[model samples]
Target: MKQGVQGSPGKPVAARVPAQARPAADGGPYRERDASVRGEHTHEERPGAGQRATVQRSSVRGQILDALRTALATGELKPGEVHSAPVLGERFGVSATPVREAMQQLALEGAVEVVPNRGFRVVERGARELAELAEVRALLEVPVMLRLARTVPAERWTELRPLAEETVRAAAMGCPAGYAESDRAFHRELLALSGNEQLVRIADDLHRRAQWPPVRHGRADLVADAAEHMALLDALAVGDLDVVRGLMGEHFAGTG
Candidate 1:
């Protein structure tokens, strides 16, 4: 199994993996393609009633990825439970190829592991490990955000308000899967304003690791967390570097 980023209390920590920038402007090592992030579809519908059951989506692979993410978030796909591509493909009513592809991408995201002949299992992370991850994210994201907040111009911060609000809406969705994706997008866009894809990619990995088996977390927590994004944006607009720093540090403190 692929090991955890920092590992839990007793688990062995793996060597830090460098973040690969997606779609590096010069076409670097990072693979630019992620089916789920393709923005190919807005909504998914399960067809039936008068018509035959059909999976309506712009990309079959994207749908599979979304389903897997939702399953992970909802505990439909529990951590440490191995599931084969064929079985998962049948569950999603698709061929094994797409399932395997989606699983491979998830593996890169530090969400799952390849279990030899056995299929894949979500990596189980402990509370301490998750807190460690939150610390790393704050270390990487906060300083850069504060630096940008000072020099990025107030108008730019104003422009990013929509993305921050988007995160709030996603959190208000009251579903882990939807909120996770939007939260990722909001942070990614916020970081991208720096014009550094590599930084954004590193933050992406940290963000992905922050989401794991939540222990009975509820909608109220999520809404409050989403509101934090707005708080960050507001602080940015206010041009208070110290406030931005404090907000960012506080946002990640107990986040995981």
Candidate 2:
């Protein structure tokens, strides 16, 4: 989460500009300038090509990281399983270099551990660990949400209805990764209202970690969890602190 409010869900929140209208992260006015400079300069004077290559590699790494995270969330990359970069690369139709880089990132995130001669091993988080994560997340988010319920305008909560609906749609799809991503998106949007960047980042990290451990939640349970998002928005829109608090508790508890 960032400073400015976004008009829609799944859009970048840092910029006031709309998602489709926002400039590319790597290419924009700078890219246009580079193109103009390239037309007048020799090959030796052009650094844009190398910079663009670096950005392309970085983009591939990011895509691989996201796919790996989704796999972890869905239990496609099972806990206690060793996944080799080369094998994962084959599965993703890329080379081992980017896959290895992605796995290194996942290692830093505590989702996997490097095995030296082998590849990465998915960390086997048990029930207690998952519960502790949920508890900590609740501790971090519940109070903030309560505060928001008291101070945030009803219309602000109303504006988030689309995000809540997105979560419901994801849940109904019965795809764990889809639901997890949507659930996080909803929470991140809600928490961003506090205007605390560090809090939002920390809480989001916890939320992502909580999603890594596989759970036995069925589609029905997922739908119930998704329903709570709407219920929370409803309570917040009406400024019902009691209902908000109760829903928040149930939401975190159900997640664990």
lDDT of 2 by residue, 88-176 (tens): 65555455666788899888778889988878888988878888888999899989998998899899999999999998998898888
> How many clashes show up in model 1?
0
What's the true lDDT of residue 119 in model 1? 84
| lDDT to native, each model | 0.68, 0.74
RMSD of each: 13.2, 10.5
Clashes of each: 0, 0
Off by over 4 Å in 2: 1-48
Model 1 stretches astray by more than 4 angstroms: 1-58
Return the top candidate by lDDT: 2
